[model samples]
Target: MSSLSTEHKLPEIIIPEDYNYLAFFISLNCNLKCHYCINLNDKNSARKDMAKHHMDGSDWAKAINRLNIGRDDLPVTLQGGEPTLHKDFYRIVNETDDSIKLDLLTNMAFDPEVFIRNVPVKKFTREAKYAAIRVSYHPGYNDIDELIKKTLRMADAGFYVGIYSVLVPENKEHIDDVMARCKGLGIDFRVKEYLGFDGEKWHGEYKYMDAISQHERKSCLCKTTELIAGPTGHVFRCHSDLYANRTPIGHILDPDFRIEQIFRPCDWYGFCNPCDIKVKTNRFQIFGHTSVEIKDIHELN
Candidate 1:
């Protein structure tokens, strides 16, 4: 498949307090198949991956245009199984306005030469807690030396990039070993807490662990604190869309769609995906954000 580059120059401005942070998964297809792929987990638990579909690049670009975000705040985060794997990857990034402040989450498997020759480093950066481009180091799927070389090359090209590794049980020792090597190379390699099972018991920090086990039938009103989209343009209220492949709250291209930051009714409390209902912090470095909030949903009409 040929890659597409979308180009649009946007003006610089401050982020508005009301603009919601946006995250878009341009494609669900990934180059490296990790054993602990969160998406693949959907196939067994939520039935999401078994019947997943993806939107074209043009559709994604149009979906992004409908969003009203600010330059200083969160621009649309373009991530995926591997975003560069998208046929129109570059086009989607370039076509967006300059004010959008593009951020990319990838495995850095693409040709840096193509990235340098085409994409400007300045396009993906802003004054934020993390770098613009966040790359992942999967011992299961990535070679440390090559990953380091690509990262350093990008940094040399003047891109604000960082590396994060998941602390999978089998790979914990390797992760630490890699972090030591990367630290010496002057690369920022951070370890993220793993949140899935290893065929024994589930892991990670969760507010209500019981909700995920399918232990019993309980009902409550829920609400989302973030914007999450599936491989397709469908926007779901929680990680359940990622796992269950349920109907989306709305499509990213819908102009009338907006975020409602409060609890509402939900009957699927028993099937909650950990990513959504888990307690976490937002862009502002503040805590108390849950992807979905529940309130007296059992009593709903």
Candidate 2:
């Protein structure tokens, strides 16, 4: 991975207003293996671990700092199976320029003392609809009391933190209980609509129902507002490509790599990831937004 030259620099790539999110999937190696992880994607086996192929913190910073996010409201979200699992997680957080606002998605499984010492309070603080550090609470894998303690610890340290759980059908009652407990403890708890199949029927609201049909394969012109960066600095067109380890649209560290805000032709319409096609809330918590805008669903034959 190479960095751009300071003397002959390419024009700064500005994040468009329509671009809802920028995700840096630092690593996919999670400490807790939840059964209903979306990364599985109906696959019979687990995807190959790419932790060894990840880019260095400095390299990540060099590439990410090039982006011109002109909005005060939008922040680049750092997430993964567990972003804290990355060895250079702190370094990457520290190295990113102060101009870039960061939001973290973690399971709160990491040592809070180490994180508090390394990451500045201001780095995660901003005027937003939700907390900066959003921790996921997986029922069986994560203990509610422990998560609350950790979140409160971070919050007491002057860092904004919150807890979110998926409303899986089986865990619906449990999630509600957890949310009530969190609210009682003064924690900003939120719930996300689960987005996968449940044996008989598929869950979630999607812009294109056929995108995840698993039966139909069609060619379409697709465009994404969100920039999805994988562990090894590879920028993917969609979440499916990122998780499947398919060919990326570009590499972040590559000086030649630049974000194109226009639509590109795609042939994997029906095989799309649930996250990409799922109709969900935006940064402002407004509903009726999908990550990718797909059109021209044509038959392969």
Best by lDDT: 2
lDDT of 2 by residue, 194-214 (tens): 988878999999989989998
lDDT of each: 0.71, 0.84
Query: Could you tally the backbone clashes for each prediction?
Result: 15, 0
Report lDDT (Cα) of residue 71, candidate 2.
82
TM-score of each: 0.85, 0.94
TM value for model 2: 0.94
Error of 1 at 163 (Å): 1.0
Candidate 1: stretches off by over 4 Å: 1-20, 42-52, 286-288, 297-301
Please state every model's RMSD to the true fold in angstroms. 4.6, 2.1
